[model samples]
Target chain A: MEKVIAGKPITVNEEGYLTDFNQWDEKVGEAIAAENHLSLTPRHWDVIKYLQNEQKNQVALSIRRVGKSGVVDIKELYSLFPNAPLKTATKIAGIPKPASCI
Target chain B: MKNLVILGAGTAGTMMANHLHHHLKTPEWNISIIDERDKHYYQPGFLFLPFDIYTPDDIIKTVEEFIPKEVSLIKSKIDKIVPEENKVQLTDGKQLDYDVLIIATGAKIATEETPGMEGEEWQKSVFDFYTFDGALALRNKLRDWTGGKLVVHITEMPIKCPVAPLEFAFLADSFFKNKNMRDKVEITYVTPLSGAFTKPKATEALTHLLDEKNIRIESDFAIEQVDNEKKEIIDYGGRAIPFDILVTVPTNKGDELIERSGMGDDLNYVPTNKATLQSKVYPNIFVLGDASDIPASKAGSVAHFEAEILTDNILHFVKGEPLTEAFDGHANCFIETGNDKALLIDFNYTHEPVEGSFPFPGIGPLRLLKESRMNHMGKLAFRWIYWNVLLKGTHIPFVSANMSDSGKHYEKALNE
Candidate 1:
């Protein structure tokens, strides 16, 4: 199967990323987004999952802030936040209701 | 028996070498400059080289070509600095004693500080533009490659020329469009800073430029390591950024020699008096440029201003008098925006970049707090002046060592 992402030659064996962490880049998360038609919310599960695993890249940049560039979240953007937003928030504040949407 | 020996003949050392040559009375005072290499580079020009604006020949020249005849030039690597004995040992096993010493043996790029950054992706897929070789390598890659994910990442903070990465992103947009490969290429700028830049005003201005170019910005990315096997840069939180090409600014640290001498801070930078360029531990030792832990901007223009004030302070120090010359962190850089336009901002230690007219208040050949084609042209013109005027310690008209408030329309500015 041709990988959605470009296959890097740095891997140890013929398999996937079970070897080391240094081989990771934002392109892996981008492959997941590309499978869908650029949908950032529900279709962005792979992005958030990878972000939650990393923890350092959590701050959300404002789209309206600069107004010059529109950057797609090509990395693990979901877990980079404090928690996912209420629309995508894993845990809802003040109440414990299993909201099926998130 | 008083002699001043400076280590490293880079921007800071060369400026001080010229400044001292002019200020100090000859024969009575002897100044010597030392570095391992013979060539001196105009560091600012490295950013423009990838775009075919500057040639490699335009940026390099022998260190001795700039040094005045009166100031002695020694080409040798420093083995270690013996601060307690007031002597420095050279790599050739020769020890040179100094009555007064200056440390300008600036910062170095340690990509090894991060995991996998220097691995298989280095230069082949990942690149750096800080060095001549790095810039040249990227230039060759950009020349032929069709395009894919172009990630411009800053691994950590306190890097040399912080804005160059953003400039690269802007220039790449202009470059790819010219090549008719804009659609094939996706450009993203990643940094540890909260916004597009360190200062909020400049960040706001720069962030706006990123949007205009359709370039993406990823902020607060503290790289834990480069996941080479996955072909990604993974964070501590497990976030990953995969790159078709990674142009990274690795973590900058003071020279390793400083660390060996046991005279530097958490980084290899020496503890310095921010106002006066004197070493905190030793009275006779002075530090400048990226070698010191000064809060000033780490650019060639900053070294130019610091050299002006430091010459006077060093004179006072020798006479056993109090140091009077105060180094105002006076600095300004012409921010190059693509499409033949640039922006200029003037600020100091206390002052943040404010929007107003520069040098001249209402009427200006150059505009302040805004971007103009004229400002962009000025950025290009500075290369000529840097070679002819700045290194020789000849003062440019209106660019005082101390930043002035007269021209800026501060009435519109909020009262401090």
Candidate 2:
């Protein structure tokens, strides 16, 4: 579904996660972060950039991998986005939610 | 004759051996399977073992019984795979050259990965049910013991039989009730995921069941350490959960041989063409089951499905044809929800489990996403089928490899 974010019509899934990365920009990301009650600090941006880069490389993202990413440990990740850090961060980063498969 | 070597004579390798032996004739190909152990375990029984629902003899069988007599089975510890040279080195320094290699070395629990998990409290209070020894040890503990805080936890994902931990929780509820001590036991299921399960509909259904069974859920808990002194598991987020009996499914990783060979990702899972089941680094090598970094559930049913698609892909590669991108990550699992009832889920790469009838569409004797006694019967019958049909690559009568969407409720899913 298309919703106006950052004053642009952006396509998102039911959970407000971006369906396409092509439509994502810093402004769009900032707006998404605000929705999750997070401010775009430099540290948060660094993690977001790292997540987007991993997504670009087609690497499956997980909390374990992110903790080992050197950009942010899991504790800092929780402190950054608070609840469901991976899901919330990925939402702001405009990537699909990390699939914690069955 | 050209050599086709299979590593790890587990579910995946044995099935591949059976499938290839029938197709790849002896005059043209020589098939050999290697594993260090002689005993083949029906791994699903590990869930029921702790509750005394199944005996050790029911799950344990000779590996050789299922392997085709025409195929060679070599029992040895594999050192490493020399991928470039297409050779496997044994611990004794012997090497076996192969034109085609199938890496079916499946995943196993690494209890050592977690701090204090195997510390002083190991097997006394802290336990894991992923292994046969662990299961039996837990069974003994549950025999005469009074219950307190029973934490059924998962350390990480991509674990073999992902639903086993939840099943453990459900079965625990029933077991304690049967022992006339239901109120004495406080069952708490802790997972790193946001909910009881991954898929939305299944999670919703399972969450409801957890509520009904009075099993408390502690979600999004990324465990950091098991404090033996305090008897509590502390997470990275500073959440600590105390338990009298801690049952955790530790981080599951592929065989250490994959790491030794430098052919795997961070978790020692091989990088493969998820569709074709062919190794991304080498064309002649194929990986299936928990060994490959395919985003499918690492369950026996998945391996069974992959074996079917992989068999055709291997044949195509041998005949100098393009590999078939046929594997759709199909997995069908029966979820045991305690009290002689289960919920059957059938899904694939692009689909979440939905509410519907299975195999027979509207006329199914089995229901999907709903609890039933028939599904429970299906779960019990699966053990016999695993030994008799699944290992031999025999197709189940009604169930096709690719998931059928005919009877599923997808219309409701599309809107979500």
Predicted candidate 2 versus true structure: per-residue lDDT over A1-102, tens digit per residue: 999999999999888999999999999999998888888999999999999999999888999899998999888998898868899999999999998876
Write model 2 residue lDDT over B210-287, tens digit each, in one string.
999999999988888999999999888788999999999999999999999999999999999989999999999999
TM-score of 2: 0.96
Candidate 1, residue B119: the lDDT equals 92
Q: Which pairs of residues have clashing backbones in candidate 2?
A: none
- Per-residue error for B246 in candidate 1, Å, reads 0.6
Model 1 DockQ, alpha carbons vs. true complex: 0.04
Interface RMSD (Cα, Å) for model 2: 1.5
lDDT agreement of model 1 with the native = 0.74
What lDDT tens digits, residue by residue, belong to model 1 across residues A1-102?
A: 123243553332232221333544545434433433343454344434433332334322221111112222423333433222222222111111111100
The lDDT values for all models are: 0.74, 0.93
Candidate 2 chain B has its poorest 10 consecutive residues by lDDT at B407-416
